[model samples]
Target chain A: MAEINLTINTQLAREILTGFIQSEITRVGFSRAVVGLSGGIDSALSCVLAAQALGPENVLAVRMPYKASSRDSLDHAQLLIDQLGVQSKTIEVTDMVEPLIQLDPDMSKVRKGNLMARARMIVLYDQSEAFKGLVVGTSNKTEILLGYSTMFGDSASAINPIGDLYKTQVRQLSRALNIPAPIVDKPPSADLWAGQTDEDELGFTYEEADKLLYLLVDQRYMPQEAIEAGFDERFVNTVVARVRRFQFKRMLPPIAKISNRTIGYDFLYLRDWGT
Target chain B: MRLQLALAQINTKLGDVQANLDKHLGLIDKAKKQKTDLLVFPELSLTGYVLQDLVSYVAHRPTEEDPVFKPLLAASHDLDLVVGFVDEDSRHRFFIASAYLSGGKVLHVHHKVYLPTYGLFDEGRFFAWGDSVKAFDTRFGRMGMLICEDFWHASPPYLLWLDGADIMLFSSASPGRGLGDNEKLESARWVERINMAYASMFTSFVAHANRVGYEDGLHFWGGTTVFDPNGEELAHGPYNEEALTYAELDLNQLRRTRARLPLLRDERTGLVRSELDRILSRG
Candidate 1:
């Protein structure tokens, strides 16, 4: 089997990512960032980058936890906050999510998790207004491609600093940035429900998933070609199916073409676009 | 005399003239600190490459009084600068051009002689080609400028050499192409070979400054470099990254090479011109 090497120069990555954050934020007439610290490697990496880009004083790391959340989650997040010397705030979503959870006598684990995700976003957005900072996102490319995040919830953000990085790349950067080893080594999880892990839900490991996805997406391999590339046919099809099904999550809501210049169609105006 | 040359390999955003000018100033400051005699920037360093329809919007005349370029002029008072930009003449005819600047004034402006139209390049569609190639005297020596495609043709460099150019600067925005056996990118390798041959044949110093960064899937390979009169690689910058590469040239070396070979002195220019005229008369 051909080996897929996705190694990156972490130092260059750090410099470019930090420079991108600083320039992008400053260009939009703001200099502050509010990142949701979920105690995961992705969010931890983003928080450290934000702190470095906009001074530690300007970055606000908000930790939103639920009732059934792991104790290690808050402790791990606090370790990063103290290490980076950025401002931190803790908000419990148990009260905000209870009324919605009560709307259904028997809410499924997925619905409850979605509710928690949206509740966290609400808190972050509120804090953004109060803190006068943009909300930097934490979703990595792997989860984003598979639609593992909730739309209008964790997926909504002003800008994302690490969205282009895959899950394994995030772990590599986390280790390079001196993230707490315990946090970096821990099994990946969203902490949405009691005892729920990401690999358990996805039925695959991130390392294997990253290689397969890199070939399928970046190398532009067909399903048969990917299967020949050592990926099981079923696994390849499942991942490809998920990526295709979740394409809507990657873009803004499609606007119907009523006129020649629809909002996102012919009239493409990015933040940097000018007359 | 020893001349210090700095190649400012930068990443320029498309259609952002003011921002690119700001980036140039920052690099110029670094070059000044290095005590560089001449600083070279990439092709379209001010407005960037890959402007399909936005070309006209960013095109500006190269003049000292232009308000947008005032700071660049002030920065050039201390060091000579070779920078690329969209050149619009007084008649509103736009061309891909490189300007040689020193002491708050433009010494010479060379419009690109060749407008590549094949494959990924569509320069012929947007720009009018330049009519002439000439070398002008500078503080360093007799210098000439060429935008990216101009250097690809053999005749342009030969014309400059015949015009008594001691140093030829080629500003480029070459996209990264094929990969080699060692897994390293070999996109700019072809250009490097051509540059080496040009310097060796003309016995003149050759410097190339290329931009880095991705623009709409086109990744520019930034292997900026300088080759001495004998085709020796003096200084080179990293590929796929922004950097400032510097090299020191000994003007006496060119004179020594010319004295030993004297190839320029034996050129049959009169015979070639007469044969060309005879052929044209027959037609």
Candidate 2:
């Protein structure tokens, strides 16, 4: 009889990152972590993990909020920085963005969104270059599952601590870590558009959607059976449909199988060779 | 007699064992009505592979306890069937097994080895690798099973062939790649090329069953196909989507080809010995 292998638990996640960071630091002799603290749960969790992995002084939280973003969002960002006792700064995106919008007011929402996401990423990357740190990602499995994240935008991060866990699970873990309550309870939003909520734009609440999806795709429940088991039929079908609809968001750009060794499906990329 | 067998490349979501079983039954009925010799399916088709860590549990429903097997057993009575699912025994570790059914009974089960444990794929974290490599007694002579990565390596099935595996079937859930124009893709051309080379070298028949359709971020490439002893592509399924391509295999050709090639006959037993090196190197 063989024993079951262990997974990456919270303790393990932290331990894995700690060891990885220390080895990387020693290998290069020194390294830091730069995080974009959106005052959101994802970024907050990332910041906390980054602080523990690298020293709080070594962890830099850059808050890049736009002018249209509410004052409460900024306050919440400060609240987290003050509570965590990490080095923080405000790099408001208003000045950087106003010129871009003025240049192309007729540009589509997608174009604007892409610009906004890229702008934040550019700031984080620039800061990371200045401080010689890695950009830690804050995306949860739910966003990654639904292809809800922008590639190279918020989606671009060096190492994601909470990428596998769902949004609800992220909140649960955040509570376990003693993060501020307001951030946990706050309605999740990209703060992408004014008066926008993650749930509203996504057409369902994170709690409602991620669970049903977890059951259907992750748990392998069929449409009728999932509904019989107390999931909304429409919601279950819709979420399953969307996951099928947007399969591209989670994968690397497809390289045709012209050669024998392609990128993902065939070609092997073995980790831990030097180790 | 030549047999035109179709390997049903269907989608199996994680944990929805019942739905996958239903799909199996439906495909079996279709195959039986078409008068096909057999219909093969992907590994873990009953309970979807990549069940996070839940697949690590070594628990299986017995013939009586497993309601999912009921329809499958009934369907197999009408048609020769090969399917994949979770099977458990004394090994506390779970097994990715392929089941061969006939006359309403599961005749044999081949547990998978070479469980992948890297990147997005994590089979080793769950099931214990299969140790045995014996070919089963089939109506079509001695046949063996290699689930997914088992066909990737040279050791396991090569040993099975030495143990009288004239026919080799690989049940897989090979992930799909998408083109820029938004279409499902069948990839891992390298795996097929190398696998076919071994089959041709060994003078054996090889049939590969890959699951089709999308599940979450992963897409199952339905490139089911069969290769003759000469490594010719006898039949190939549609890329990135579902299609049950059928091929007629003449078992008599297997013996005649082995005689013609004489590679298997002319092999030296002592030189390039695999097992002896392992024992000697362990010291």
lDDT of each: 0.86, 0.73
Highest DockQ against the true fold, candidate: 1
The two-chain DockQ for each candidate, comma-separated, is: 0.06, 0.02
Deviation in angstroms for A86 in model 1? 1.8
lDDT of 2 by residue, B181-262 (tens): 1122224566567668877888888999888544434546567878888888888886555677788898778878987898
Per-residue lDDT of candidate 2, residues A204-242 (tens digit): 888776667666665576777778878767887787788
- For lDDT, the strongest prediction is 1
Pairs that collide in candidate 2 are none
Where does candidate 2 stray beyond 4 Å?
Answer: A1-275, B56-59, B62-65, B177-187, B270-282
Q: Which regions of candidate 1 deviate over 4 angstroms?
A: A258-260, A268-270, A273-275, B9-37, B48-54, B63-80, B88-97, B101-168, B172-204, B210-224, B229-233, B236-246, B252-283
In the range B51-123, model 1's lDDT, one tens digit per residue, is 7566788888778778656777788898989888998887888888898889998899999999999877878
Model 1 chain B weakest lDDT span, ten residues long: B177-186
